[model samples]
Target: MNNPTSGTPAPDGTAKPLQERCDNLMKRIDLLITIVDRGKGDKIVQALRDSRVTYNLSSVGYGASGLALVDMLGLTSTEKDIIISVVPEERASEILNILLYKFDLDKPDKGIAFILPISGVSGPIALKYISGLQQARP
Candidate 1:
């Protein structure tokens, strides 16, 4: 019989599935977006999963309604989420877009998000763990 993936090995030979064994290392970034109906920054942190959050002067609202809404009182009370996770670049864009539309990000500053490059990754074996995690998740 013939081999589809070179199905059989050679004399005293070792045949392994051909996967790229490259030394080229890479980093990935994950983005997360959260939205709340005003005055709920504290609730945002409560809703997070697997994150150690530290916000920096994050504020949102229109006018004195600020954080509340004009039709409403006290700060409009609206907020958004922009989360970041660094992984392999191969998976970065996937996660970015996942948050973009998943969180209705196209509608102006309803929310903002982006990703950046990272350096000094260990190696592929270390990176493969992330891939394994993905499989285990869903």
Candidate 2:
């Protein structure tokens, strides 16, 4: 009997190993973090949604730097909106470009956005959810 959990068969008629498929999927996952001025979290989250990101979290944060130089340079703000998002690695660059150009994150005090490699996830269920594969399954 064909196992549903097994990887799909290749052109040569041999099934690709499930572990290999899972590893590939995991490798394609990445974390995107964007820090913006207070009250801008919604815009950032909306951008992620428009980019097809399925999962994201946002929270308020305060700049911890107390250096006089930072204050003098107008480089710090007391209130910040931190947004954490899950995105496919292949689309990470494209999304970042959107944030950079559209949001002006490259300009000082506008905001900062970056991508981090996700080494692992809790389990397949979580992985599928983050990867948006769960929605593909009926």
Candidate 3:
């Protein structure tokens, strides 16, 4: 469960809901998660490392995302690392809850993120693992 992105210095920079209706003309996007916490966010990073179902791109949160004061936009998420992944429609909600609760995604400025539509995935095994993690829930 080692996270390769762990300890990696982020540029110090930089979603939506699982449901809530998206635009019919807009393209479906992948699930992108940006985790963060004030003081030290390494623990959350380690937690993601331990239970990650999928790992895409992870980088340090900074810049505008860090300058964010409210949680509506991802600007407030720059305090930590951003993890992006692609998950199926059915599995998106579960992943959201995990980040929101399992990872406390709703901690306001603590660091919040959202998921969008995913067109496709390059790694099916990785997708399966992520879906498996969602299914193995409490």
Candidate 4:
């Protein structure tokens, strides 16, 4: 018999192996981190949503500068917004471009964004939710 879902026949005429089905469902995930001046977290989150990202966390942060000038200018600890988002590796480049060009992250003081490969996740359910394969629970 053949596997109706994958349209591929099992070698021994049995249900397709779990490994084969899992291979097709798994996708590499990356962590996209963005830091911008205060009050920009909401905008960044919206941008990620527009790009089809399903998981993101935003938090407030403070920037510490060692320069004396910064202290004199009262800017040693500047308020910032830190946005961490989970995105698929395949879409990393496209989203980075959006941040660079659309958000002007390439310029000084505009903001900064980068991607880090995620080695593992909790399980398939978490992976599917983060990768946008399934809707998040209300």
TM-score of each: 0.40, 0.73, 0.46, 0.77
Off by over 4 Å in 2: 1-27, 64-76, 136-138
Residue by residue across 58-112, what tens digits does model 2's lDDT show? 9999865568888888876779999999887888999899989889887767888
Better of 2 and 4 by TM-score: 4
Candidate structures ordered by lDDT, highest first: 4, 2, 3, 1
Model 3 scores a C-alpha lDDT of 0.50
The segments of candidate 4 whose C-alpha lies over 4 angstroms from its true place after superposition are: 1-24, 135-138
CA lDDT, every prediction?
0.41, 0.80, 0.50, 0.81
Candidate 3 residue pairs in backbone clash: 10-60, 12-61, 12-62, 13-61, 13-62, 28-117, 29-117, 29-118, 65-75, 100-105
Q: For residues 1-138, write the lDDT of model 4, one tens digit per residue.
A: 333336556557877576665554566789999998899889988888988887999999986645778778896548899999998888899999988888888777788999999988987768888877675322
Rank list by TM-score: 4, 2, 3, 1
Residue 20 Cα positional deviation in candidate 3, in Å, after optimal superposition? 30
Candidate 1 lDDT over 51-96, as tens digits, reads 3222223345432323334536543434443333343456556655
Give the 10-residue window scoring lowest on summed lDDT in candidate 1. Answer: 18-27
- In model 4, the Cα lDDT at residue 96 comes to 90
Which of the two, 2 or 3, has more TM-score? 2
* Candidate no. 3 TM-score: 0.46
TM-score of candidate 2 on Cα atoms, chains taken together = 0.73
lDDT of 3 at 99: 62
